[model samples]
Target: MKVKKQKRHRKSLTFYTACFGFRKPYKVLCDGTFVHHLVVNRITPADTALANILSATVKLYTTRCVLVELKRLGKSYSEAL
Candidate 1:
């Protein structure tokens, strides 16, 4: 008998942002994945847009959980930031 593994569902940051009611002068909670993209990937249009939006109207934050994950990702990844 074969048993299938179910995929875990995750909510998007936009969903949390809406739930938190962020409006003008927004505050964004950055996840490790977003940080990874920003650090490892070459600058793309999306990255530039994100940077511009953040610079213009948003404040970014991260949690201890994210820090822990980053640490787990190892020194090279952390140092890249």
Candidate 2:
């Protein structure tokens, strides 16, 4: 099942790279919720995890708004920031 999922993800990545010129060291945009999930689930070393999922090198990015949101959410979410 995991192999199948990986293959499917690879296929989708291929499509994006081919048609949209997405390249490796793929850039991943993360939101507050995503960061929270990572913290809550103890998904440490987020870049490595995302890279494995995308089957390529990855760079994670978050916007100022996301940072603010996480900050506003307070201490429980502070680790995510």
Candidate 3:
């Protein structure tokens, strides 16, 4: 006797949309380079792009290491950050 195989059904787009009704929050780690680019020259295209990308659904965070490095780079810039 031959056994019959059953086909699996995939979830629909509406099912996924209903499952995720709200945008998920994201945590982003900020390093020395990101901070430097942000504070340097007041603003740049890269900074603007970063801002646009992180404006929604993201929270920025940094560690003591990054702060210490920024401090060592320059007092004014570090303070701005």
Q: Which candidate is the best by TM-score?
A: 2
Off by over 4 Å in 2: 75-78
Tens-digit per-residue lDDT, 1-81, candidate 2: 399999999899999989999998898899988888988898877898887898789888888888888888886665653
**For candidate 1, lDDT tens digit of each residue in 49-70?**
5545443355567788988899
Better of 1 and 3 by TM-score: 1
Best of the candidates, lDDT? 2
Q: Tell me each candidate's TM-score.
A: 0.50, 0.87, 0.49
Report, for every candidate in turn, its global Cα lDDT versus the true structure.
Answer: 0.58, 0.84, 0.57
With a 3 Å backbone cut-off (N, CA, C), the pairs that clash in candidate 1 are: none
Worst 10 residues of 2 by lDDT: 72-81
Per-model tally of clashing residue pairs: 0, 0, 0
Error of 3 at 24 (Å): 2.9
CA RMSD per model (angstroms): 10.3, 1.7, 13.6
- lDDT winner, 2 or 3: 2
For model 1, what is the error of residue 44's alpha carbon versus the real structure, in angstroms, after optimal superposition? Answer: 11
lDDT of 3 by residue, 34-64 (tens): 7787676565444344445433344567899
**Models ranked on lDDT:** 2, 1, 3
Task: Report how far residue 48 has shifted in candidate 2, in Å.
Answer: 0.9
